[model samples]
Target: MNHQSDQYYIDKVLDGQVNMFSVLVERYQSLVYTVVYRMLKNKEQAEEVAQDTFVKAYKALDRYRGDAKFSTWLYTIAYRKSLDALKVNKRFVSSSDIKEIGEENIELVEDALSCLQAKERKQIILDSIMKLPEDEAAIITLYYFEEKSVKEIVEIVNLTADNVKIKLYRSRKKLYSILHISRNEW
Candidate 1:
């Protein structure tokens, strides 16, 4: 939707036009779910957290001041909600069972990157991202996948710009390392 259209919807949402918020929801559900799934790495939990993120966003709609883009605000909620889910899940699962995303995706890429196939590279990148720390993963996903800026990331992640830069640098390094280790440079 256009900026003017979204703003109009936001006005509706803020003025007790609760159901109108679904337009916002339909617009951003995938973005929110991707953030949650990237962080939690568990489909079920990601879905739950994504649902909660929208619910929380709706309840706080009146308080939104538009200091940041509405998308940024939604992501901030999803990121925090996903982190909370991870903390709770961390207590119950063994690390290995959690499946390091880097390694899993690497295996997927092995098949796709070859002359005979094409799905491997994406999986490799995704796996490497999954292996990153939560903050790094969020930065990579937001910056690379969602095409958000450092400023937007800073607001959503509640980090300073410098920290976001550092995280992005480190994340790129980790991703390169995975590629290097896999001997699949492309």
Candidate 2:
């Protein structure tokens, strides 16, 4: 691990030692890739987006002010890139499908999930999260999986705190619904 702060690496890169940029990429690639994979739900597309994210960040490194944490800024870029890809892919969710996963269904699945092995439960939750719409998946992944604060998510997704909270609520319902439907397959 690079003991130096992200700013130190950023400064090194900015000073023309571009190799320092690779260190930053190595540091955050998994984080960026995870955000993209959860939203895109495809390993190949997520890999492409993750690469593009670093390239874009390298080019735009000069414009980065010290306002947000480096991870948050990189996340904002990753989130936007995922949106662009989703717009092109045009994935949609059927309301009928969501409707099938009713309000009461969440608790039933929650109970069943508690009996699952830790790794199995986490994998199930992650798989269910991937089934969400792009925006919802991103919001939920940032909030729950990445443990980002509402304000941090607001900056990453460019949503208001209230908007992030509302999406978090809706995403959980949809995730539980998806889980309920998929439960029988396990």
Candidate 3:
């Protein structure tokens, strides 16, 4: 079912058919988990944050004005909850550690990346993304994997459109650098 139909289930839940809420959870759980996992990088913590996101959304269902898509609203909650978890756990990676690799190394890595099969290439890309800072990783995941527009991302991450644009660009560059270096190490 599409996100538009999410409103129907939401209405049912609000009207006291709470079991209908499970449909919303089943529909959105993966999207929410992806956002949290990209930010948290911990399976256990990401799962917890994802559950919390759904609970929070369920509790705040009455306030959902439908001005935005349900996925967008759910994503915003997941994003905020992930940030809160990051703050509490202090799991953020330091920027200084993300060093630039040499041009020759980059080319070697690029060649290795291209040589891999599709599934392997995807795994390598996910690993590289996980190495990035939380905000950059979230921006890349939301923009590329989830196909969220810059405006939708802005609403989710509370960044300006220009900032999201810049982050998407920089995050791609960073991911390339990471993939290249990681491939070389193999």
Top TM-score model: 3
Model 2: clashing residue pairs?
Answer: none
By lDDT, the candidates rank as: 3, 2, 1
Q: Tens-digit lDDT track for model 3 on 21-106? A: 99999998998898899899999999999999999999999999998899999999999999999999877698755654322323
lDDT of 3: 0.85
Give the TM-score ranking, best first: 3, 2, 1
Q: Kindly list the per-residue Cα lDDT of model 2 for residues 43-145, writing each as its tens digit.
A: 9999999999999999999999979999999999999998898889886655654434322323344456667678777876776776677789888888887
lDDT of each: 0.79, 0.84, 0.85
Q: Candidate 2: TM-score?
A: 0.87
- Collision count of model 3: 0
RMSD of each: 3.9, 4.3, 3.9
Better of 2 and 3 by lDDT: 3
Clashes of each: 6, 0, 0
TM-score per prediction, in order, is 0.82, 0.87, 0.89
Off by over 4 Å in 3: 1-4, 96-111
Better of 1 and 2 by lDDT: 2
- Model 1, range 3-60, lDDT digits (tens) per residue? 5566789898777877888899999999899888878877898899999999999888
